[model samples]
Target: METAFIESPLGITKIVGDEKGISEISVLSEGTVSKKIPPQLKECVSQLKEYFNGQRNQFDFKLNPQGTDFQQKVWQELLNIPFGKTISYLDLSKKIGDVKAIRAVASANGRNPLWIVVPCHRVIGTDGSLTGYAGGLWRKKWLLEHESPSQQQSLF
Candidate 1:
C-alpha cells in the first residue's frame, strides 16, 4: 500500500491505498510527515480536492476499507447520507435493521477508515449535536459547516 499526506482545510490528511482501491483516509491535526505522492493516489487526491472545493458531491474511486462485516455495512449506509443532510446514529441503526445496535452503529462510524469518502461525518448525536469523530470535533464542525449551504459564501 502507498501512503502520502495532503494538506486540507480541516487539517493534514493521511491517504493510503493501492491499485485495487483506497484502504484508508485519515485526518490528522499534527504529527504528519510529508512523503512522495504515488501515481496510484492521483485520482483519490483529485477527487478529495473536488469534494473540499464543493465541486463534487459523490466520489467515484474504488475503495477497500478494512473492517468487520458489520462495520462495512454501516459505512455503506453512511454513503447514502445526502451531501447536505445529516442522520442520527439511531436513524442509522434503524436503517441497518437493528434498532438495538445504535451504539454498535456509532462505534462502526467512529471506526470508519475511509473518512469523508465514507461520509461518517454525516452522523450526529440523537440530539443533533456533534459527537465522536476521530478527526477531532473542530474538524468535524468545519466539515459540517462546509457541507451546509447556509454556511457557504456566495462568490458572486
Candidate 2:
C-alpha cells in the first residue's frame, strides 16, 4: 500500500491506499507532510482538501477499510448519516437493526479507519455528548464544529 501525509487543521493527516481503494486515513499530532502524493491517492487528497475548505460535504471515493462483517455493516450504516448531522450510538445500533448492539456499534465506530471520510465523528453518546473518538475528543469537537453549517468561527 502507498502512503502519504498532508497537513490538516487538526493535525497531520495520513492516508494509505492503492488501486484496490483507500484502506486507511488517520490523524497524527505531528508528522511530516508528504512532499509528493502518490498517483493512487491524488484524488483522495484533493477531496480531503475540499472537505477541510468547506467546499465539499460528502465524499464519493472508494473505501476499502479492513474490518469484520459486523464492523463493516456498522460502517456502511454510518455512511447514511448526513454531513452536518449527528446520531446517538443507540440510534446507530437501532438503524443497524439491533438496539442491543449499541455497545458493539460504538466499538466499531471507534475503530473506524477512514476518519473524516467514514465520519465516525458524527456518532455520539446517547446523551449527545461527544465521546470515544480515536482521534481524541478535542479533534472530534473541532470536526463537528467545522461541519456545523451555522459555524461562524474556527475553534482555534
Candidate 3:
C-alpha cells in the first residue's frame, strides 16, 4: 500500500491505498505533509480538499476499509446519513437491524479507519451529545460545525 500525508485544518491527514481502492484515511495531531502525492491517491486528495473547503458533500471514491462483517455493515449504514446531519448511536444500531447492538455499533464506529470520508464524526450519543471520536472531541465539533449548512458566518 502507498501512503501520503496532507495538511488539513484539524491536523495532518494520512491516506493509504492503491489501485484496488483506498483502505485507510486517518488524522494525526502532528506529521509531515507529503511533498509529492502518489498517482493512485490523487483523486482522494482532491476530493478531501474540496470537502474541507466546503465544496463537496459526498464522497464517491472506492473504499476498502478493513473490518468484520458487522463493522462493515455499520460503516455502510453510516454512509446513508445525510451530509449535514447527525445520528444517535441507538439510531445507528436500529438502522443496522439490532437495537441491542448499540454498544457494538459504537465500538465499530470508533474503529472506523476512514475518518472524515467515512464520517464517523456524524455519530453521537443518544442524548444528541457529541461523544466518542478517535480524532478527539474537539475535532469532531469542528467537523460538525463545518458541515452545518445553516451555520453562521462571522460578521467581519
Candidate 4:
C-alpha cells in the first residue's frame, strides 16, 4: 500500500491505497509517511483537491475499503447520499432494509475509512443535529455549511 498526506480545509489528510484501489483516507494533525505515493495515489490526490475546492461533486477514483459485508453495504448506501444533502442514521438504517439496525448502521458509518469521498459527514443525528464524526464535530459542521444550499449570505 502507498500513502500520501495532503492539507485540506478540514485538516491534514492521510490517503492510503494501492493498485487495486484506495484503502483508506483519514484526517490527521500531522503527516507520517510509511509508504511512498504511487501514480494512482497522485490521481486520487488531484481529484480530492478538486472536491475540496467545490470544482467536483462526484469522485471517480477506484476504492477498495476494508470492512465487513454489512459495513460495505452501509458504506455503499452512504455513497448514494447525494452531495449537499443530509440523512439521519435512522433513515440510513431503513434504507439499508433494517430499521432495527440503526446502531449497527451508525457503527459502520463510524468505521468508514474513506472520509469525505465516502461522505460519512453527510449523516447527522435523527433530530437534525450534527453528531459523531471521526474527524471532529467542528469539521463536520464546516463541511455541512460548505455544502449547504444557502450561501454565506445567510450568516451575513
Candidate 5:
C-alpha cells in the first residue's frame, strides 16, 4: 500500500491504497502535504480536491475498502445516499434491511475508512444533531457545511 498526505479544509488528509484500489482515506491532526503521489492515488487525490472546492458532488474513484461482508453491504448501501443529503443511523439501518442492526450499522459507519469518498459524515443523529465521526464532530460539521448549496454571501 502507498500513502500520501494532502492539506484539506479539515486538516491533513491521508490517502492509502494501491493498484487494487483505494482502501483508506482518513484525516490527520498534522502532516506535510505529499510531495509526490503514487500513480494509483492521483485520481483519488484529484477528486478529493474537486470535492473540497465544491466543483464535484459525487466521487467516481475505484474503491476497495477493507471490511466484513456485512460491513461492505452497509457501506454499499451508504453509497446510495445522494449527495448533500443526511440520514440518521436508524434510517440507515432500515435502508439496509435490518432496523435492529442500528447499533451495528452505526459501528460500521464509524469504521468507514474511506472518509469523504465513502461519505460517512452524512450520517447524523435522528434528532438532527451531528454525531460520532472518526475525524471529530467539528470536521463532520465542516463537511456538511461545505456540501450545503447555500452559503452566506459575502456582503463586502
Candidate 6:
C-alpha cells in the first residue's frame, strides 16, 4: 500500500491505498504533510480536498476499505446517507435490516476505515447527540457543521 498526508481543518489527514483502490483514509494528530503523493492516491486526495472546501458533496473514486462482511455492509449503508444529513444509530440499524443490531451496527460504524468519504461522522445518538468518533467529538462537530448547508457565515 501507499500513503500520503495533507493539512485539513480538523488536523492532518492520512490517506493509504494501492492500485486496487483506496483502502484507508483517516484523520490524525498534526503531522508532516507529504511532499509527494503517490499516483494511485491523487484522486483520493483531490476528492478529500474538494470535500473539505465544500466544493463537492459526493465522492466518485473507487474505495476498498477493509472490514468484515458485516462491517462492510454497515459502512455501505452509511454511504447511502445524503451529504449534509445525519442519522441516529437506531435508524442506521433499522436501515441495515436489523433493529436489534443497533449496538453491533454502531460498532461496525465505529470501525469504518474510510473517514469522511464513508461518512461515519453522520451517525449520532437517537437523541440527536453527537457520539463516539475515533477522530474526536470536536472533529465530528466540525465535520457535521462543515457539511451543513444552512450554517451561518461570519458577519465580517
Scored by lDDT, the top model is 2
lDDT, candidate 1, 42-124, per-residue tens: 89998998999888888998999989999999999999999889999999999999999999999999999998999999999
Q: Model 5, 15: alpha-carbon shift in Å?
A: 0.5
lDDT of 4 by residue, 1-156 (tens): 888888888778889899999999999877654345578798889898887887777798899999999999999999999988999999999999999999999999999999888999999999999998888899999888877767424575
Could you tell me every candidate's TM-score relative to the true structure?
0.93, 0.95, 0.96, 0.92, 0.95, 0.95
**Model 3: per-residue Cα lDDT over 1-156, one tens digit each:** 999999999999999999989999999999999999999899999999999988899998989999999999999999998988999999999999999999999999999989998889999998889988999999999999999977635556
Candidate 6, 1-156: lDDT as tens digits = 999999998889999999999999988887999999999999999989998887889999999998899999999999999999999999999999999999999899999999999999999998999999989999999999998877635555
Worst 10 residues of 4 by lDDT: 29-38
Q: Which parts of model 4 are misplaced by more than 4 Å?
A: 32-36, 152-156
lDDT (CA) per prediction: 0.90, 0.93, 0.93, 0.89, 0.91, 0.93
Residues 35-104 of candidate 2: C-alpha lDDT, one tens digit per residue: 9999999999999999998888898888999999999999999999998899999999999999999889
Total backbone collisions, model 1? 0
Which pairs of residues collide in candidate 2?
Answer: none
Those runs of model 1 whose alpha carbons end farther than 4 Å from true positions after fitting are: 31-35, 152-156
Q: Which ten residues in a row have the lowest lDDT in candidate 3?
A: 147-156
lDDT of 4: 0.89
Model 2, runs deviating above 4 Å = 152-156
- The residue pairs found clashing in candidate 3 are none
Q: lDDT score of model 2?
A: 0.93
* Backbone clash numbers for all candidates listed: 0, 0, 0, 0, 0, 0
User: TM-score of predicted model 6?
Assistant: 0.95
